[model samples]
Target: MKKPSLTILGCHSSIPTDKFYPTAQILEMKGDSFLIDCGEGTQVQLRKAKIKFNKIAHIFISHLHGDHFFGLIGLLSTFHLLGREKSVNIYAPKGLKEIIDTHFKWSYTRLKYCIDHIELSSKKLEKIMENEKIEVYTIPLKHRIYTNGFLFKEKPSNRKLNMKEIKKIPDIKIVDYKNLKLGKDFMTKKGKIIPNYQLTFDPPKILSYAFCSDTSYHSPIIEHIKSVDLLYHESTFLKEEKNRAINTGHSTANEAACIAKKAKVKKLLLGHFSNRFPNIKAFEKEAKEIFFNVEASEPLKTYYLDY
Candidate 1:
């Protein structure tokens, strides 16, 4: 099975510079790509990261902030120009659909494919999307505007067939493989029963990731993201600028670390840095003071969620 991974396409705050772009990332899980926050220059970064545009069928926008979703119109136009036939699903705050419709209406541009807007308005944690292999939930966040973080969780997998054990038993045939994989005991012709544990191996561990976008120090999110394999939280400032962070509706590195520690997440990634900090390593340093398994998010870097 392919392991889940996240690629940071852009990790800056507010503006795009030569070295950094605004918030954007691609979470590749269960053979599907989920685009999180399409900041300015997101398509360019996606190309630089060698990610295919067509693979991104679902997009999760954290908010209506320009820095978080400015590039969305351009990407949609590009999809039309590229003659894409597959539909795209966008999960975002309520006003996004109107914005896109206005842009297209004024530009006299129409898309060949369908664009389904899944507007979000819940102020509490809720399940937003799901498929056979994975489930997605919303983590209500506090920002200048209405915003939401996303939780991606892989569903429990079916038990694997213990081929070696099966071969040793003549009663176990190909017809019984399905039941064995479903954690069902095998029945022999003589009415002897073989336990499922002896016939199959346990399913692989489920992996989960949470994306905490531009939000202040909010502890209520801890329950929604508890024990996640990976967490990407926005840390726009250091502890020295705690006042500034609060004023701007952003979290400091220290605050981000505190949330990670409380949630007991396996790993914490800090991003959405203010331009004032030239050396991003300071964010990592401050976060490490509280949470050991923390790192500064690097643009274009891929972080894997695996055992």
Candidate 2:
């Protein structure tokens, strides 16, 4: 199966630079795209990347930080201007619903598409958004204020029906074929029960991606994010700024790398850089000392979350 590709829409920290934008990521799963954290100038970046705006069916906002959610209103309004009639669901923190309501109410901006809002907190890891092909869950992260990270995971499922195998079993009913895809035993009318494991092979283990933005140095999450295909943790500062990072409720690059290493994740992506450092290599250098698979994202460059 083809895996989802993740695009780094913006990778700068709280402060924006000419070389970087704030925190925004695009995860392309199946045939649709999911926008995570719509920072400032997101539409321009999307256009520059040549991604269709209409393909974005849902948006997930990490927190109330301006750098994380500043561009959402503009993006939604633009979708309306583009004559979009489908509802766009937004999963955000508790305060987000009021924020959007107040902003739109005062400005009196109506949307062409229905805006569906799903507020996420430090709740159970369950399906927040789902479709026929994919299921998305929320991973709780320790951050200043109320911030919850997102986990986009492909459901562990069965393989396509082997028609040749079924054709040999002329007594096999079509419903039995469907049952095989569901990993269920197929019982013929004459009590010929074919165990699902024998007739249908197990599909490959599902691939998963987890996004952790604006989080402090957290370790308990090792259980939640263990062995994920891809992990994007915020590297807000270098070790020298550990005090500043802790004071500001952020994590240094070394700290982020530590968590990633302990979690045993497949690939580690560090972003959300402070504008103080003119060079992002500082982050990569510090992180590489800890985790082998690390990449500091560049704006508009899509990284495939390979399995």
Which candidate leads in TM-score? Answer: 1
Taken over the whole model, the C-alpha lDDT of each candidate is 0.95, 0.85
Report the C-alpha displacement of residue 123, candidate 1, in angstroms. 0.6
Per model, state how many residue pairs clash: 0, 0
Which pairs of residues collide in candidate 1? none
* Residue-wise C-alpha lDDT for candidate 2, range 72-134, written one tens digit per residue: 988988998899998989999888889888988899888777988998765556568888778
- What tens-digit string does per-residue lDDT give for candidate 1 at 1-307? 5789999999999978999899999999989999999999999999999999999999999999999999999999999999999999999999999999999999998899999999999999989999999999999998999999999999998999989899989987788898888899988889999899997999999999999989999999999999999999999999999999999899999999999999999999999999999899999999999999998999999999986
Q: Which window of ten consecutive residues has the lowest lDDT sum in model 2? A: 119-128
- What lDDT, from 0 to 1, does candidate 2 have? 0.85
RMSD of each: 0.8, 2.3
